[model samples]
Target: MKLKNNHIATFLLSFLLTFLCAIPSIAQTPNSTYTIEQGDWLSKISKKAYDSPHLYYRIIEGTNEKATSDASFLKINSANDIRIGQKIWIPGLPSPKNLTHVPKTDCEIRLWYNYQIVAVGVINEKWMQDGIDLETRAHKAYDLRHKARVNARFMMQDKEAVKTLQARDIKKYGNPDGPTFTYLLNKSMEGGQSQEVAYQTIIDSSSKTDTRYNADCQ
Candidate 1:
């Protein structure tokens, strides 16, 4: 029996995550075939062939059963694997011989990470508002969480106090960066500091906090 590769899981996870997040627009459309090449993500290929990247998931969903069962599935940069010269079914597309059309722009971005909250800047009640799309909002949320995590790591708080905050599961209150303000407050409280001291500490380090939260949530 041949051993299965770990990269397959990674690829499936990446693909599935994106698929679950967005509603595929080309689910019922026709398909075309193409040979794989270097540095080709599904989005890039879909964009090249369909004129839109949002339709990649439809292709994946169409071919997922085959890809899932194969041992050499979804390998990164492996020429003998799922790389160059591999014939792939491009779903929700037309015949390559008849494909001479450019896909229109549909300002969107896809994210493959996690998020706890959607930003206020990206969401509104309008049917087609000017704010960022859901995909871009997801990416921005991840970026915000990552930045918060980094900030939490380098925060100039007492080590023991910070540890105490972590031990208390403060991350549940906010993104992966830890609680925007509660993490520091927890640390300060652990260190026997008053609310005034905590507020002053934040004021002193205001340059580092996220400017979006500087004005407080309305």
Candidate 2:
């Protein structure tokens, strides 16, 4: 059957419009979603995906609007808010490149304690290769840790120093454990001493009144 010229023009025009409209949907990048595992937190997601915990807000911002305005805004504990196979949007996050993920190298780590510069350390290639970077906020934390350890040691050797730290701890962080740094150091040397675990023990012991001072009597 012979088609009218006007009808053929309309058909071709319609086809062109349809193809143009499909470009955006076709070009859209497929989003990858992560299930909330036990111990998962916004900070952890930000760290794993964006390499910075400060980017947690970005993840919140990237969620679908329907998810945002509802009860799931900050309800991180709810499984329905985040579950297996849920299509979450991870916006502006770069895809992994190569067999080994190479973290960005151009970053610096500096630490300040009580508004004074305490220590500064470079984020070396080794740390970056191991997926550790200045973005992790580890260098400043580790610097403070070293400073705390040195101060703790000085306090252990000198009675006056111990009193000074105790006073400072009470004024700033409140209540010092009776067993003190001298005892903690001894315990720390006995094989395993993960800094996090050790710090937790110190905090727990300091908070508890039942724990005796110098239980070892050394």
- Listed in order, each prediction's TM-score against the native is 0.26, 0.23
Clashes of 1: 3
Which ranges in model 1 have alpha carbons more than 4 Å from their true place? 1-30, 67-82, 93-136, 139-218
Clashes per prediction?
Answer: 3, 0
Would you list the C-alpha lDDT of every candidate in the order shown?
0.43, 0.42
Candidate 1 residue pairs in backbone clash: 51-103, 148-177, 149-177
Whole-model lDDT, model 2: 0.42
Query: Mind giving the per-residue lDDT tens digits that candidate 2 earns over 1-218?
Result: 35788899999999999998666322212244444545556555666675554445435445643255654433332223565334344445322232143222211111111111111222233344677544343433434444544444343545676677567766754445223454554475465877556544443232211102211211
| Distance from true location, Cα of 99 in model 1, Å | 24
Candidate 1 residues 13-71, lDDT tens each? 99999987575333322465555656666666756766654445445544543456664
